[model samples]
Target: MTARPPSPRAVAGRILRHPENLTESEQFQLKNVPTHYPELDALIRHVRSFAAMLTGRQGERLPDWLAAVRQEDGPPGLHTLAAGIGRDRDAVIAGLTLPWNSGIVEGHINRLKMLKRQAFGRAGFALLRKRVLLAR
Candidate 1:
């Protein structure tokens, strides 16, 4: 009986994350499977770029990133993301460029969410709001 062929996924995944581990035939097979992970690959790259921008405080690159998102032949979600960025362009830019961070507000919001979950069904809106406002 003949051996079943190796899954393209194995070859492709290895080639991407650890090319040195693959044999010549497996490496050659990678050329055939680029389309299999195209969207995932693009997502990784775009996310890395976005993280770099925030970490580096390179707000000026927002426009270019938005442009790339709009132009990429990616999933529809990307276009929606581009539209969101466009709508809040100024605020996003400010968050990137300014030393000020929304971390404090976000922390408060997260605390409120946790408190709400803990108080859900046991309390009314008034109590929930009071807890959120009064909590340290």
Candidate 2:
């Protein structure tokens, strides 16, 4: 019988994709795959790091993280998303990092919209404004 050994990248890929397929020691090696190919590992790290940054509520770190996104590296999807984010860079950063939100403002907006729809052609702007001011 003959057995052909698996390539490190393939082995690592399997370990990365399906850790449940390997033993404890093999899973441990998957964690260390960066040594085999730094670029692949780095790309993975960039993705995970970006995700971690987004999940955090630290607005102060937003500038640096956005710059990292703009950098010519990581996944192409990230670049596309970053470009979209760049359209409202300030707002995106605020959304990602700030602990506060515009829930109150949005609630008011929804109320105003509802009032407008309810009063469409029936009541005038003045009446709508009064209702907006008096509504709970």
Candidate 3:
């Protein structure tokens, strides 16, 4: 029997994943992605470089990367991403360069929102406040 082609989700996951983390079979699958979809080659390259920048805190390279993306005849999604970044260039650079993050505060805010949604019309402010404070 012929082997089935990989699903789009699988291909996307492989493209987004770090190269070192891929298994042998996954690596093989990823290598074949560009053969099936030629446009994906550029997407894969851009995604990998962007991931590297994020991990390496190479914010200084963003301008060049954005310029390349804007100049390329690649996917429209990429252009959109570049435009969005351009609109908030300073904040994006700060986020990529700075070591500090609001992860803990965001997590707490998310938890509070979830609790509020779950208790809507079922509980009052006192119960919601208690749930938020008592939550681990």
Candidate 4:
């Protein structure tokens, strides 16, 4: 009997994970990806390169990478991503290269939003304010 193909979500998880973290079976499946879908090979390369640049703070390479993505017959989604990045090139580069981030502020905002949703129609602003201030 033919072996069952890996699920799309499983394949995507494997692709997104660091190569060193993959198990033997996962590595084998990843190795066969290019054979099953040649176009995905280019996508995988581009995605890994982008991930490397983001993690390594190599924002200087964004322009060249964008150009390569636009020039190659890569997946259409990558072309869209390239265009979006082009629109906010400076901000994107700064975010990628700089050490500063608004993660804390964003987390607080998310928590506040979730609290508000949970208390919707059940509490007044004063109670909500107290909850926000007292939240750990």
TM-score of each: 0.58, 0.44, 0.90, 0.91
lDDT of 1 at 130: 91
Candidate 3 at residue 93, lDDT?
Answer: 92
Model 2 misplacement above 4 A: 1-51, 60-78
Go through the candidates in order and give the clash count of each.
Answer: 0, 0, 0, 0
> Quick one: best TM-score, which candidate?
4
Model 1 reaches what TM-score against the true structure? 0.58
- Compose the digit string of candidate 2's lDDT tens values, residues 8-103: 676647534544567776666656666655555646555555556666666566567668767746556767876887788788778877788889
lDDT score, candidate 3: 0.91
lDDT of 3 by residue, 1-136 (tens): 9679899999989999999999999999899878988888888989898999999999998998999888877878988999999999999999999999999999988988999999999999999989988988
Tens digits of lDDT, candidate 1, 19-79: 5666787765654454565774565456657777887999999999988888788667767
Q: For every candidate structure, what is the RMSD over all alpha carbons to the true structure, in angstroms?
A: 6.4, 9.2, 1.6, 1.4
Task: Provide the lowest-lDDT 10-residue window in model 2.
Answer: 11-20
Which pairs clash (backbone N, Cα, C closer than 3 Å) in model 1?
A: none
Candidate 3: regions farther than 4 A off: none
Clashing pairs in 2: none
Stretches of candidate 4 off by over 4 Å are none
- Model 4 has an lDDT value of 0.93
